[model samples]
Target: MTQVPFGDMKAHYQQFKSDIDTAVSRVLASGHYILGPELDKFEKDFAKFVGVNYAVGCSCGTEAIYLALAAMGVGPGDEVITVAHTAVPTINAISMTGATPVFADIDPVTYVMDVNSAESKITEKTKAFVPVHLYGQMVNMEPLMKLSLKHRIPVMEDIAQATGSLFKGAMAGTIGEYGAFSFYPSKNLGAFGDGGMVVTNSKENYELLLKLRNMGQSQRYHHDIVGINSRLDEIQAAILGAQLPYVNQWNTRRREIAKRYNEGLKGLVTTPQEASYGAHVYHLYVIQTENRDEMQKYLSDKGIQCLIHYPIPGHLQKAYTFLGYKKGDLPVTEHAANHILSLPMYPELTNEQVDHVIAAIRDYCKEKNTASVATPMSAQVAGR
Candidate 1:
């Protein structure tokens, strides 16, 4: 019986135990826990990696987006356009700014915001577009940027899932007005605890973010504007800094694992696809199947852990009922919610473990006679 976990953070930590421990010790000795040198260095390093002029660190990804929206002046009576199939935080961040969250359906194949659908939903009230880079694959930013310039709407990228993903040679988060990232332990660039970053090229926006994260203070105890206390702590920043150097190598391994999964599970499941315009970092090797529930149960029984990235689209959730979205409003998003399953995915996932997981899924598919039904979308599947 093979036991493969969905994500092994412990394994990840163990791989870098020495460096991480040293970083943590250094931070502990500094005695400046809140917004110290660690945070500053990590922000600079992350900004350099993403090719942004400034990167602002915050408590978590949700706040990162909220800060971006708030700083960009998204407020009451405004509407923020985003895909329905994303972490609730994406919508919550918009709503927290007292703006209406406008939902758009995702592209069935990419499971990202459908640009056309998003464009149609834009109105006079639409203030910003938040294209979630879900599952480590970038949304098509080329058209999204054009739409942003045309409609005069600022684009805030929810890059919680994509850290190193590229779009036409540019990094995923750098193309938008603001890019928000999460370092939740399961992410590709997981920190020891909750962390997030917002990046931007505009000096004006960057300065606004710095003020917003620290209660609108340009100087200590000098409140410039009403803001929230959401600074990224020094400990988490140090941990992130330690992990930062290895992100590219980890992303490469994740892609290799995804390729193997695609080849092994070709006809058994609808695997993730990399867009022609960008690279996928394989944050979670999600697959879609008609028998998602049974498949998950089968894998669980075989000691292969599997989970759903999202079982329900955000619009259909009880929290967003006021948004006026119903079940059939977004067919593609609804369909994906019912069928997507995230398999064991991480940089540390071994070939043997990946093979075992694939073998278990194939066994279940054979027993259930679930031949692949991914047509039109099959060409989009990575390594197909």
Candidate 2:
């Protein structure tokens, strides 16, 4: 059995070893590690890339969301609407702000927030709408933006998985009032460790975010309102700056890999879909099937690594029991949780490995179909 690894981080590291090393060394020599020049440069560069006027660096993506909410005065008795099928961090950040997370069902095909469901759920209490760009594809943003305008509510984009993605030529994060991003080693533009940023066009919100991240101090120790320590350190920033130049190239390769997967695994399983209005970075090439558990086991036994992006929807989790959601409440999200599977996806994946994965899946499906069909038909013929 040949071992095919899932995500090749080592291969990614080796691709830019010299530049990463130099970036790290430069940061080390500066002796200003936390919230230093490196962070400044990275924030500026990232802001430019995302097509936003300002970007504020923070500890992690969750903190970025929290800070954005706090900056916008989203607190107790507020309801933030988002999809049930997303990283828990999205809900956790809302919870951190002492706000309630109201979940809307995902679009059955795109696995993003269903705008109609979201609009129906909104009420006078809806302080914000967090449209997560899940799986490297933006949600249906044009209608969502119109809804936002109609309600006079703020929109914060949870763009952790979609750094380079676009919706109607506008970057994912920049479409809303605030865009939160993550660099958690596996994202399209990952850092060496935990890092995040919040982007916005409003100068007022930008200044507020800076203060909120630094213990509410406009200057040294002149504390204002209460805040937390959520600064993005210099090492991570330096590493991110080193990798930022190649992010577009990496994203292009990921799209190519996704195209191959779509072609190779077409009829046997329900592959991912790319909506006409946006581009997907293929953070994880997820496929759905009724026989998901068996397929996952077969791939594992065959020395191929695969994983479930999420096995449980946020509404159904034990932690959200107080939200009063039952199993059948979110039908689409619940169904997807049981059936979706993420295959090996990274820019470093080679064509040979992709072909191997495709062949293995086809072989498994062929045997299963053959056995099920032959036995039943043979028995029918005998009865006849």
Candidate 3:
């Protein structure tokens, strides 16, 4: 039996071993590990890639969001609106700011934040809107920006899963006031270890973020304001910088794999819908089926590894019970959480592996008696 892992970071390293090893060797020789030239180069290069005027390297995605919010002075007595369907780190970052994370439902088709639901969650205390680009798709930013302007609220984009995604030809992190990206080992442009970045066009925000990520040091331990120790280390910065050039190629491969999954699994499952407003980089190729748990088990038994992007919505989690959200508060989010399952996704996955996984899913659907109503790929496109 052939086994397919959800993501093979070791394989990824092996593929880029030469470059990664060289980067590590150079950084080790430099002996300047913290706040060094490598970090500066990567920040500038990443800012150029994202078409932003400034980019701040941080320890991780959660800190990226926290730094952005802190730069904007969002804290206690403030409210930040975001979706309940995203990674908990999104909410955790908001919580780190001492602000309340108000929940909003997601769009049924795109599975991203619904602008209308976000608008409804606003109040006088609403400080910012953090629209998470979940599963490599950018949210509809045009209307969201209009809403931001109308309500006088800032937009912070969570680009953890959307490193190279685009919206109306604009880069993912460039459209909002702040864009927070994660370079976790499994992302489209992942680092060898934990890393993150925050991009912005505002020089003021950029300067403040520099201070916030380094314990509020104005210059050499002269504390200016309250902050945290969240600087991106030299080694991780060098590794990410080396990987940055290949990000677009990797994203293209991910899209090609997604297209294959859509074609092969169309009728058997509800395939991901890419909104016309943006390109989906396919961070995780998710499918929706009524028997998600059973299918996951079947796939596991077949030596095909699978996982759920999220099995529980953030608002309904036990840790967030104090938020006062109940089971039915976010109907779409709650419903999708039960049905969505992520198939193995990575640029390095071969066609044979993808076909094997697809065959397993097709087999599962056929046995479950759900193939009779499988929809055509055309019919399953967005806005249907």
Steric clashes per prediction: 0, 0, 0
Q: What would you estimate as the lDDT of candidate 2?
A: 0.89
- Report every candidate's CA lDDT: 0.90, 0.89, 0.91
lDDT of 1 by residue, 126-221 (tens): 999999999999999988899999989999999999999999889988899899999999998988889999999999999999999999999999
In candidate 2, what residue range of length 10 has the lowest lDDT sum? 371-380
TM-score of every model versus the real structure: 0.97, 0.95, 0.97
Q: Which candidate do you rate higher for lDDT, 1 or 3?
A: 3
Task: Give, for candidate 1, the lowest lDDT window spanning 10 residues.
Answer: 375-384
State which candidate, 2 or 3, has the greater TM-score. Answer: 3
Query: Candidate 2 — which residues are off by over 4 angstroms?
Result: 370-384
Model 3: per-residue Cα lDDT over 1-384, one tens digit each:
888999998899999999999999999999999999999999999999999999999999999999998888899999999999999999999999999999988888788998988988999999999999999999999989999999999999999999989999999999889999998889989888899999999999998999999999899879898789998999999999999999999999999999998899877788898999999999999888776788889999999989887998999889899999999888788878988889999999999899999999888777876762323223333432
